[model samples]
Target: MGDYDDDTAFLGQTGPYFWTTFFLLNTVFVSTGFNGFYIVFIGASPEHRCLIPEVNLTAAWREAIIPVMSADGRQALSQCRRYKLDVIRNLSEQGLAPGRDVNLTGLEQEGCLDGWSYSKDIYQANIVTEWDLVCDDQWKVPFASSTLFVGYLLGSLISGQLSDRFGRKKIVFISLAAQCVSTIWQSFSQSWRMFCITFLFVGASQISLYISAFVLGTEMFTKTLRVVFTTLGAFLFYCIGYMMLPWIAYGIREWRTLLAVLSATTVVYIPLWWFIPESPRWLITQGRMAEAEAIVRDAARRNGVETPLVIFRRPELQTLHPGKTYTMLDVLRSKNLRCITLMCLVLWMAINVGYFGLSLNTSNLSGNPFMNCFLSAIIEVPAYVMSTWLLKKCARRTLLSTFLVIGGGVLLLIQFIPAHLEYVALALEMAGKFGFTMAFSIVYIYTAEIYPTVLRNVGMGMCSSAARIGSITAPYVIYLGTYDKVLPYILMGSLTIASSVVNFFLPETLNRDLPETLDQMQECQGLCSGPKKKKCVENGGSGHPAKQHEAKSDTA
Candidate 1:
């Protein structure tokens, strides 16, 4: 590709504008299809249902079910045993739920004798099966997350490489289409086995989605706003999902119904089939001159600027032969490239171990798990904002290391606090959340910036796969380490700190235009050979001869 001017550069920044719109839409409804909420489904108190089955608890429980509100006093609701309450209401109306506005005593299920466990407050009690609800099979639910992550690890590795070969825009749509199809299939899953299998396939597609989403965002934007736009694009994830899930969940109580609703969300993305632009960089690299020209022209048209179509015309570079495959070995040979690969993997693992692990622990923070999840995720907005601000001012090393230390310290502090101290735990967890959120945003931008242009996608692929690997193992570690409440958090804290130590060896990327070629990558490492080759500096980027001449001149 030839050099682009300010107008065309601004067009790259504009790419994020388009992504920011649809990405938020996707996050609002679609992303919810993938979650560990099954943790709550099987592992939660029996009051929560996994699917739509009205569990027969008639033989369980023998304690009196207390009513929180009573005309006389806090009276018992049943015949000296637990009684089930179902709140029926008109879908179109409010304030007419069965027990509150109508008689429920007559509608109670037969053989209603069960038990009620008193809430911590004496004012209320919750009915549970008098007999313990056996959750043996349910205990395996968390393992589903591991399986999903394995899918993610596999998909990220595949899709990241595929984008380079197949093109980023195509993969973005394919991943979305795949996720939608998977969720739609999930809505129809008849058993837990089918549910797990469908979700596993869904998991495979999601990592591909994450990879292409970032790839599209970066390829569309200019060097100046690249990190800014990409980080902000990620913020859309929590920004929309946190608010929308509770509303959607409340209405769609059945898991299958919820899955169907999210699957239908793909319809909104379908219009992108028409409006979304093919990635300009992908176009140039693939040497699709005519198609690439039209996209740049359209972007220029939208922005009221002119980009000569010739700039999009094919350039005579080392073009790929038909079916010429890019192998993993190409990624391994460059020392600079190898370091970037290592950093991407390290940063990804540390972030997932910290991000997912903290999200799991945060549920224990408050009485209402929904409120806790939302409130903590809500606080993540400021974290993303803080990340953007810091990215602008701090060196990559300084910002990443600072957040690593801070997040690690706060996570460690969670160990000393009492388990029931919910509010204090919330405060500490939020601090940890803030730090990790920044670290997460930083790593995304940092990995993209550090890799040379040719290998950026595969480099990101390795980083993303590393993250999925961490995510897969995070639950297993948490489940096993539950022997001690503090072990998991403490361990994750150490991982982030280790990431801090590793961040030092990576070069600072602030103010550096992205390295486009191998020789430019060498200059980035302080290995530029000589001064005379510097004459071609104004020529934009060139190959080894430009720099090799400088080495020859230095000998004189």
Candidate 2:
């Protein structure tokens, strides 16, 4: 009923908080639409002609799940051993007939007409050629999966900087529409080369929407709901994907078809491109004071503040706060920042390693790939709801560390559980999922909170880049487990524990101000880096609170 003052007619501009929330929720969900579909696609994307029955040929989708070196001696699946198919195919012109040869690798139509067999590699690839990879050792499955992350890692690095330089709203439209259109092309890809190119573009474009949304939210909202709302945006992203992809996967078994359906949701997000606001903070940072003032006044008028246009010049930069600005070097110049950066990098690594590592091994989670995926995913809904609640009541640092420790503890404990406790291990994995999920959700907010505004995006982006490094490594981590399935968890649990231990030394940030200047950061009490005050005889943190806490403490 109130008069809206957005002259540009931005969609989410000057609306009730719910509409803004709805806007952000849709933004985050669409940004991640490609995730689960990519997972299912990677497994089937290399299948023979994207054939349904040909899904049985790839290491990822093949029915006879066995380790690289070991298979049951008497089992008919002696033909199912990994990497055995390529050895026979080089036999060339001396082709073995289906009726006469023992296919150590499967003959196409194994359960079908018996005499119709050919070289298992050619046969697997021949009938079904569209989406599945024939893993007769002719291709590397882990590397295939790893390539996508390679693309994701590369894409995330520059997407943020690109999004910031361009308008957030403009880039969002470009990335979303481009990715949706690219995905449609993916369904028609005839070769792995084409699939990789399309996936790379999808990964690059999709990654742009997220941090832009986060930055936009931070700038628009009041401090009251900032953390909760920002974190909630991230939480819904995974929760929705977790809830939707598996059900959709079961309904649409063909990976290409499923991707088409998944991409269709993003088409809804296309129209949203015209509506979201240009981040006011970005405008302020770019010295567009006139525009920044306009947006702020528009929101204030809507909120009934009727505030005046104000300009805050840098008095400190002119003389008062000498040596206050930070560069990337400042991140490592102090022992405190160095350790903080390293520890955070490790924590990011462990979470990525564990999350994607376990996730990539979807085949081993259970026999019914679809159901197992569904349960693993659906669990995130309740877990995310609980995380949101805990973030509100609990100290952010404590909650983060506790989740990491618990998630890691469960992973370590799972290794020793007896076979009768398969359910227990699965439960542990889900527990770790919750733990890791909580950790992942908080870290984005946490990282954003901890870094000074000047370095905030770059710092988070670099840290996220490190996280992507772990993402790249994750496929191999889980892939190696195909050689010995338990090894992946052992390594992941160790990494997670190491990450938790690292968190112990990190500066506790509860009820703290976000730092505005180096002096403010250096003077901040009990900062995670090093206890400057504590170093004065009895080591203890003592400094001014970060800028984020300044308004709060004064009121308190």
Candidate 3:
């Protein structure tokens, strides 16, 4: 029945041991961002048109032979179709003026028979150019993006259980290796199917590494630094990796070369396996008392703190859980746990869908795609910093609701902006991105805090699995831009607003001790003792509201 916090108090919460582990943990965090959004560059569609065969035709003849089609409500030359080749050749041979003499508009148009030509302006190569994933095959692009998230969904389910069953440090290295290998292999893919298969592995490694790092950090740090670690430590570095992608893509225009470089760079992290240590909390949970004690003693030595052997000799601390096993059932069977899990699942899905939807939509913004992505990633830095600050000062529920509403409202407003004011639309969209990024950062920490240590990884993983569902749908949401530019924003905005309202029903987690067991969590009875729980105290039973109030004050 003893808490690990008591033992942690002796190790000194902040010290050389902690900082060293934090540094190593963040190395993996940085890599996660690199591959996380590479899909942006790899799947980007460059300007393209049907290839014109060289048949000694004059430029005017070539122009008249290509059919015109409407794209985004504007007339443009068709990318997938052209005039019949024999007709064009005959017209060229006859020297007939196409539209004036021959009435070229009446000629039969056909799909690209000679393949397509891509503009090498922004990207020289990507999956789209390589596979000709345009026109009739356009659906494959979104499906490819969705494949990566499919891997994320699968990985999220298993990583937590594996890490908990094995060790966080081991799973971290394993996933990093998988990600690196899969990324390199993906670059060499000869076909779209091969790329998608490799991407599945890449996606799996991405979420697994993230959860491993997140759970490891959670178990290692005390409550105060935990907020910083989740928001600024893990997430800020992820943004840095994201910001680097456009530059990487800019320098290495070829997808294979770009992927090779990114994958090879991760070799630098292989040595980290030897340096980082397993979590002592996890060690203790497994009844490995001697091993946990040794790590704690070493940490004490590094931190210049002295600890008597008697501290570890306490029977309760030594055998806190001799053979306790927690499963997903523990989370589902209880009323409070079930409510919180369901709410968190919804919150995670909304945050992820909106966040990824806005993030991947950078190409559709008014500015250059590279600069747009760069700025999008840059904006997250301040958003995460503010989120970290707010996590300490604001109630979790309050921040979640407020940020979601602001983000959703901004997205909703973007639809009404005049088309001529593209810059204004972009600015509003960026503001919405900022709001969602803040919410994104908060939700990770919030969800982690809501679950007990035993179920923390599983809980976060399940929530992350829900997030993958949002992510899988995100590309389709962005794909909706092909039909109606503003539709994605409207859909994401409405979902965000609905989720924000649902967030109000969630319990605030600020300044509370994390429950270590399902029973301890059930006892707390769902946000019944927080600063905002005054109404609950008045009612004295499970805090069923007498009246649903819109806003409530919270004291720190």
Candidate 4:
């Protein structure tokens, strides 16, 4: 097949059309960001203790009813247990006072059988407060978050095939509408189970919109612009939305109202359908040359340039196979492609584990929850900016590994900091977040470059599904803090460090042409035989097209 890039080069790198399409598509990330972490505030666990009815007991006795437990070297009132109400009432009736007359510690204790009372200093209402999802039921909170990721996993798997078949623009709007509806549904949920059920749809639709827009941008933009759009344009806008979340939640402390407001804002994006066009590259792939030509001519006209009478060359159209389609299995069937896919899956998973783990754990950190979430979101802006600059200067493999190591190493160092230095701990956490955010942004561009155009969305979708595994596990990692505050950081750091080591095994994609087919795919020259490595070196690390085809046939 003739190269599609050459056919579309006349569109130029910058123009009114390019800028309009770029900004419109990137705006989708903002809404995705808003929904992605909605769980943090909606399911937040506020400080709580057992509910004791103030009936017959004295004020002193009432205060003593909640048992004190030592945790992290400090004493705090027990969240789940309280002194027996009947025993306390009897003791009070017998003219005995707490501590002075009757040793309160020696009295019988029981679970919060009367239910719980939540502190409203941070949140007036949330899932935890609304349903009393604390103590024995606290696992449900993380389970709820995991449920959303399960939807993400499913969405990532399905969105690729659907987008490839239906067209990227169609899927984007469909997902946008679905996300808005699901999020609004979640806000009105009467029960925790109902909320989680709606959250599943929320996750599915949110990720579908995200990946579709991502792929559309990747296909539409020129090579240089691709880097700028992915790193700065897409990610920075998402961070802006992420930063907006805590401030919005801060003002609207009630979870339902906050969710309603966020979901409703998505209605504004519906009109963008007229502004953004279907990817011309995708249209060409489907053999819809006329439609693709029309888009380019329109873009050319918008740029005040004249296009050739015939935009796409005739010979290129003959080589196209509109009926041919590839699936996830195509990548797995080839040994080289399979190896690349496997490594990418693992890398994406590890990156997600560190990225989402640190992100979701913000509430558990040692500062104001809103500030912690805001700092976590805001740090990504510089991270994306630095990554954009470094993508041009550093090798993809080395940069990714370095970022992971830095992120993981700093997180591990948090264990050594004194507990009294909470601000210092927060700083280290932010630094760690900075590292992971950089890695997270880099991995997207890196993975996209590794896969050929025909299988890019399929491969990215597969990797994203693997990432959902990490995201699904992340909330529980944060849940580990229930037992030990430092445990989550320790586990995330160790996994991130190990992932950095695994990254060294993958091939570098810096300064290389985007592979349009499996035959042009780059191999892991760093790990291959000397002769093959020499061949790769001679080809500037883009593996021999003939050998790649032979390898695929051999593996098949």
Candidate 5:
């Protein structure tokens, strides 16, 4: 592989132009985060019960007409039951006092016959309020969330190839437009089915926008800038967006209004289409050398740096063979790649399940939902910082394994806390979230480091698609908690720990020069032979022989 950086050093690696592009990409990422998690709040189930109109009784008596019943054997207000309306109506009409005059428990109870009434204390409106998706239809709410992840799965499978075939810049705008249009449609949806179907588009567009921006940033920037952009710039801004969602939901109150407001934010990105440039690498792959050079020249001019008239033609930068193309089969054909890909898929799925499960389960926590959601998002800042430092110091396999076990173990422990000690349970759940946060942050970088460049996108797409399975299943996992509070935690914890055990089999990728070909990847098998063999290769053996000629980083 040719080192394009050597020929393009004149462009200035970390310049004002780089920062400008970085921030623009970060802005798009921020919106992606907003669209991705907003469903948590928009689909929230607020305090509700069967609608009992005060047609003939005093307000206090009217409220008392609904019989108190336990759900899942846990004491709570019954959401699906009400005193037989005819019985209650007759009693009120006869001027008979309820509770005292009649045996409310002996009275025949029935589902919300007329309709269900909702409490406005927590939320003025949500999907639960608008569509009556409670009790019998309660499962629909999480399935509604699952619908978005289904879109994510589809997007993950197709977006990478689409961006590779089409330009990243083109797909981004198209996905953004699709997302905005579908979200508007969602706001206007009269039925739960319509809302769910439109959210599929929202999910697809959200992932497409995120992947396109990520690929473009990876190809356009130098090493330091790419690392910073991938970590602090894009990711940190995403956390900011995630943290903003609860506040937005708190202020908007109505689900439709919130959807409309969030949809409107997409329009803000349209102008950036004119400013963000296409990936020069992709342009070169398409044999559009002149166009690629023009972009580089413009970048140099913006940064006030001088560049040669023809930097791309240099011997070190001239191998424009369009790079090796890979498909899913290419990954499967190799024994080493197959194991690595499968392990990564399992790990990603577990991490996502734990991450989204904890995220969506916030409403069920004992505190204010907004505060819980905010804390969930806020905790990631430190997690990310810790992950960055650990990545340099710890072996990838060891760090990933340890975090998964910690996260999973904590989740399992949370299941044991008594109901009265809700705050303590909340603390343990947060601790679990913090652990999964670290694991989630490391997995992306680990996957990138594991795959060779040719198969990187396919590998990442496959793993992320697997992750969508976890996400698609996550809402249902939360639903399981209603049956038994410990079920979801047990499932998530078990999966995490099981995947952690599998982590030991995978080779540690820390500090290794990324494998560039199938042959180079074969050398990765030696990772199992122990650090002595790896150290011998790093010192100048068959492994990463190419690194000897490359400039060693001072940071490395």
Candidate 6:
């Protein structure tokens, strides 16, 4: 592959223009983080019970109407069922005064037929309260989250192709506008169905903008900056946005007002279109040398550097394979590529399940939901920083599996923590989040390194799709909490631990030259013959002869 770094070196590594573009493009992640998990607050299920209308009844009788149910070995008022209203009203009118006079449990029970009354202590309004999605309709809450992931799945499928066909800048702005508009539209949703439909659009647009901006920054920056941009810079900005969510949602308890406020913040990004430029690398690929050169020249001028009249070299243009294309089938056809791709899919899926499952389930934790959520988001900062620092020092497979096990193991341990030590459980959950966040960060860099350059994008798209599937399944995992408070932890922990075991089966990628073709791809030597394993170790950990020769040649 030709190095565009050489061709664009005259533009300088850092400058006012570069910093401006970097900050502007990276800020998009803040919005992505904010909007992506807003559902946790928007669809929150506050304390609620059956709505018994104002009737002439004693306070004890009024309280007795809502039956007590045992949950997690503790007594709490049932959200769904109540004593038959007629029976309760008649008893209240009969001058029966105390619980001692009547057996409350013996009374016939019925669903919340009239309606449900919600407590306003935590949230003034949310989808659960506004649409009465409680008891029998409780499934809708998780399904609403699933709807957003469905949109994420759809968006992931098309965003890459769309950005490659159109320009990255166009997709970024268009998706931003769409996200802003759809979010505002969602706040006005009168019905659950409408909210979900608009939310699907929100998911689609939000992810589209995220992916486009990420790619734009990747292509625009030089090699060193590219690593920083991908590894730490963009991710930390995303964490900033994630950290902001709880604070914003904390102040604005109403879901609609929160959505409106989030949408309003996006309007600031509109003027960024003028500041962020189109990717010159992408422009060069499209055979628009004139436009690519113009942009490069402008960058050089901004950086106060001189450039030759002729900027882009012929070899850089030749590097573009406009006629060649690789698909998921191409990745599956090769033995080595298929093994790597399959392992990546499982790893990505498991990491996503653990990561997103914990994120969305923050409300179900045993503390202030706002604080729990903030803790979950804030923990990612150290996780990302640690992962970035370790990327150069640790073997990819070992580092990834160790974090996964640590996360999964901590989550599993949470079940044993006494219920009274709710703070301990919360601390363990944050520890779990820290582990998975590190794994999530490592998997992206690891998966990219594992695949050959030709199929990296396709392989990443496949893994991302698998991740969306996992995210789609995550809400339902949280829904398992209704069955048992510990079920979500048990299931997520088991899956994560099992995935860590699977991680060991794949080859390590640290310090290895990125494979450029199918023949050069590394094989899974975890189960290879002794001789083959020795050869692989001798050749910098590539099992294939072509890769060995390349390693030797580079060493020589």
TM-score of every prediction relative to native? 0.75, 0.76, 0.92, 0.95, 0.90, 0.90
lDDT of each: 0.61, 0.57, 0.82, 0.86, 0.78, 0.81
Question: What tens digits encode model 4's per-residue C-alpha lDDT throughout 205-292?
Answer: 9889988899899888877788999999889999999999999999999999998999999989988999999988778768788898
Task: Point out the higher-scoring one by TM-score: 2 or 4.
Answer: 4
Candidate 4 wrongly placed segments (more than 4 Å): 314-320, 526-536, 543-556
Per-residue error for 330 in candidate 2, Å, reads: 6.4
Error of 6 at 161 (Å): 1.5
lDDT-sorted candidate list, best first: 4, 3, 6, 5, 1, 2
Question: Candidate 5 — which residues are off by over 4 angstroms?
Answer: 9-13, 53-61, 71-75, 91-96, 99-101, 303-320, 323-325, 512-544, 548-556
Candidate 1 residue-pair clash tally? 8
Clashes of 4: 0
Q: Residue-wise lDDT of candidate 5 within 131-249, one digit each (tens)?
A: 88888988999999999999999988888777767777888888889889988898998899998899898898888777777767866887657656666766788888898989998
lDDT of 2 at 87: 32
| Runs off by more than 4 Å, candidate 3 | 312-320, 522-556
lDDT of 1 by residue, 1-556 (tens): 1243232564554454444444543352336423434233222333322121234222212111222223123343432222343322121134444444545455344322333232232111111121223233323555655767777888878987888888877888888888888878866755556666876778778778777767766766665556666565555463555445645555554556666776676677676666666676666556565676787777666666666645532232334232344556777776656765676688789988887776654434456655666666676778877888778777887898999899988988988987567678778888998898888888888877766556678878888888987888787667654356678888888888888877776656665555444445522223322342353333232233443343334223
Which runs of model 2 end up more than 4 angstroms from their true locations? Answer: 1-22, 33-37, 41-76, 81-135, 309-337, 517-519, 522-556
Name the weakest run of 10 consecutive residues (lDDT summed) in model 6. Answer: 525-534
In terms of lDDT, the poorest run of 10 residues in model 3 is: 547-556
Off by over 4 Å in 1: 1-138, 312-325, 522-556
Model 5, clash count?
A: 1
Strongest candidate by lDDT? 4
